[model samples]
Target chain A: MRFDVTILGSSSATPIYNRNPTAQALNINERFYLIDCGEGTQQQMLRYDIKSSRIDYIFISHLHGDHYLGLVGLLSSLNLNGRKKPITLFGPAHLKDIIQMHFEYSETTIQFDLEFRATDPSKSEIILDNQDITVETILLDHRIACTGFLFRQKRRLRKIIKERVEELQVPVEYYAVLKRGVDYFATNGQVYPNNELTTAAEEPRAYAYCSDTLYNESYFEQIAGVNLLYHEATFAHDMLDRANETHHTTALQAGEIAKITGAKKLLIGHFSARYKTLTDLLDEARSVFPETELAIEGKTFVIES
Target chain B: MRFDVTILGSSSATPIYNRNPTAQALNINERFYLIDCGEGTQQQMLRYDIKSSRIDYIFISHLHGDHYLGLVGLLSSLNLNGRKKPITLFGPAHLKDIIQMHFEYSETTIQFDLEFRATDPSKSEIILDNQDITVETILLDHRIACTGFLFRQKRRLRKIIKERVEELQVPVEYYAVLKRGVDYFATNGQVYPNNELTTAAEEPRAYAYCSDTLYNESYFEQIAGVNLLYHEATFAHDMLDRANETHHTTALQAGEIAKITGAKKLLIGHFSARYKTLTDLLDEARSVFPETELAIEGKTFVIES
Candidate 1:
């Protein structure tokens, strides 16, 4: 399974010349989950050649224009392109109303099934549970009701040793049971240990996305030990006061959170437009967490567990 | 006087890869007037090396997100860049409310003066008149309340013959009167005719922008005989029915409007995302009006009167 995170946009509330606003894609196994669609997200997806049909769900952090202004346009484009599959969207209660009003005023009737789930940003909860993955939301501190998402891939079943299964004369019908760590029994009631016939399953990978939030240690407990963590670094250390005033996290603060959470790697982005060059931000973050990397647009970072 | 029209963005409603939404700059003498600030219009201005300080006025066609989503962001950037001059904005009535709400929520206090004037999309009237130019609104047909703009440079003053003025021994202060088409007289009651020392001024130029409008001939009277006319062509002739159904226009329809308006030249843009090549659109428009040309991004077309 290829588990990775792609940075679709890395800017903060404002739009800049080259940097885009907040958006990313988490690919778990073969499915893709979009996070925080900014103003030009659909065009970014097209520029990066990401197949929009592969997106199964979208997780929005808040109702800020920079965070999710592109949703209606993306949905309209999907309808224009003849998309029929159902897409699940998780966000605040008012998002559906906003999108509905835009479409209603424009008289644009979408052709896809959009299943919306209102997420309470005050508590941690499991928002989605599928066969291959599970998605949980952790509350974050922001001006508005905001939540970060943690996507954890489900553990795969152990594979049975083909030679051992053949020697044991296991029927093809019993393969499912064998893969589930169960031993195949003979008609004479002879016992075979399950651990001896099957190899252990691979370790599940996990990714956490913390968007547009202030430095809050409470979220560390929920996203601790994640293979990859993406946190918004809207300012550098010099603007710590501004970050606190605006309810945003500085690069150093994001790195400190990564350090406290013991995350495998830290990806810092959502840069403010004030800083044209991110060298100072990267240096400041790396001083706190050695494994921290700046989130560049259109680049994919693998999550290894 | 430097008079030309520079295309900042040529794309339509939905932004495509590398192609931005509708935005253009009309340079009349030293003043630059912007038209239709779509998403990333400020970045487009920066990319095309347009001086932000030189831009004195902005005319937005409608409230559609693609037409004016970038205005707030552009204003924020202008404040960040330390612009102190006042900027006048002309758009629909609701736009002021939208911009105010965004700025209030973001807590961004601008440093420069932002003068906003609401345009009535149902009428054709002169909205702005300055020392060197006059801006008028042309009612357009769209899904929303939309209007285009006509920028006409003020007629230039006649040139004075410096040698003739010196020979007549006119006072230095009287040179201003001479430039204003007034004859200068000596204290001895000597008569000097205005035509003897002055040459006729060049004819002023006019450029009309008809953005996101359907094939409506009612606007021909308002935009008739413009030196340059830019009309939206969202589709080719094959999709003429779709264009009409969506309240848009085809390339042939844009050319037809240009021909009806008796424009010196026509520039067609606002291409649909389905078109990867614009050769066919150019050919189709030229078949109707031979002076038609496709609007290419970052390309400047002179408005020859």
Candidate 2:
């Protein structure tokens, strides 16, 4: 299974220092999920060679311009490109109103079905579920109503030993049952043990995205033990006071959250436009969590299971 | 008088081949007026070194995403940067609803007063009047309610011949009145003629911005004899049928309009994304009107007298 995330943009509210606003692309087994599309996100996707047509789900963390302003433009282009397949959008209820008002003024009816599922910011609950993965919303503390997302891949089925199954003359229909940890019984009452023909699969892995939020522990348990955790570090340790005032998190606070949550790795981004150089911010994060990495735009990070 | 236009974006509906969507920045006597702010406009303004803070007014020809989607983002940034001076926006009446809806969702109170002046699409009217110029709306023929803008520089105040005014020992209190082209009478019964004290200022120049509209004869007389004309040429002559179907103008038709209107210079843009190179479109326009020039991004065109 391919589980990786590409940072399309990492700048906070303002686009400066050649860094765009907050946007990311998550690929789970070839299913593309766009998260928090900011301004210029379509151009960034084009620059990074990410096919916008493949994105089936879009997750918006908040209603801030930097988080969801590119949505309408992207949707317009998708319609222009003759996209017929329906796409699901997860965000606050008001986001649908904003998108609809523009289309109404333009007098354009979208050719594809645009389904909006509102996310609740007051509680953590399952928002999406499929055969491959399940997504849950993590209530966040921000100036505006915001929520994070947690993606957890389902555990893989047991691997079948082809030679053992063939040698035992197991029927093709029994293969699926064997993989489910059941013994195969022959017509003559000869049994093929499941343990001898199968091996355990890799454990389920999870990824979490938390952005534009203050340091709060209410939803920390929901994202505990994630393989990868992406958190916004809008400022460094020196600007902790400013971060608190603005309902943002510092690099040190992000690192501490990752460590306390037992995340395997930490990805920090949503950098403020004030810092032209990010070395000190990265170093500050690494001081607390050595597994920290900067979520640089156009770079992809894989989740290992 | 610093009457020049900077092409911030020029590509039609979709931004492709490194070409951006439609956006323009017009500078009239150091007062910047942004016209048709598309996506990535602020970034384009930053790339071209155009100061956003200097933009006092914004004009939108229509509600298509390519023409006005960037307005809210730009307004938000202005508020974030602590802009206090009021800025007026001239567009359709519903444009105000679209802008206000987004701000409401984000729960942001714009620090600056945002004034919306609705433009009437049924007839021509002066939408904006100031000391330097008067802006008139040109009722356009398009699929939607759209209007072009005609900027006429108010006739400049008569220049005071510096040496003549000093030689006559004209009192400072009479300078403003003298520039109004009136004869000055001295207490010693001396008469100072206005012609001897001032030379005729250059004739007032006009610039017309016609975009996202079909070639129509109704507004031709309104923009007759303009110094510079910017018209949308969305397609080449070969694609005239497509242009007509989409209610857009082809390069050949744009040139014909400019020639019939007697514009001194023609600037053609709003190119279709299908053409990676714009030479053929430029050549097509130049074939009919030799004064045609491509409205290249980041390039400034002077509306000279």
lDDT of 2 at B34: 93
List model 2 lDDT by residue over B87-175, tens digit each.
99999999999988999999989999988999998889998899999999998888899999999999988989999989889998888
User: For model 2, which pairs clash?
Assistant: none
DockQ of every predicted complex: 0.38, 0.65
Instruction: Please give, for residues A210-269, the per-residue lDDT of candidate 2 as tens digits.
Output: 998999999888999999999999999899899999899999999999999999999999
TM-score of candidate 1's chain B against its reference? 0.93
lDDT of candidate 1 over A9-48, digit per residue (tens): 9988766778887889888777889998887787789888
Model 2 stretches astray by more than 4 angstroms: A183-196, B167-178, B182-196
- Backbone clash count for every predicted candidate, in the order shown: 0, 0
Each candidate: what lDDT?
Answer: 0.85, 0.92
Superposing all C-alpha atoms, what RMSD in Å does each candidate have to the true structure? Answer: 2.7, 2.1
Compute the lDDT of residue A299 as modeled in candidate 1.
97
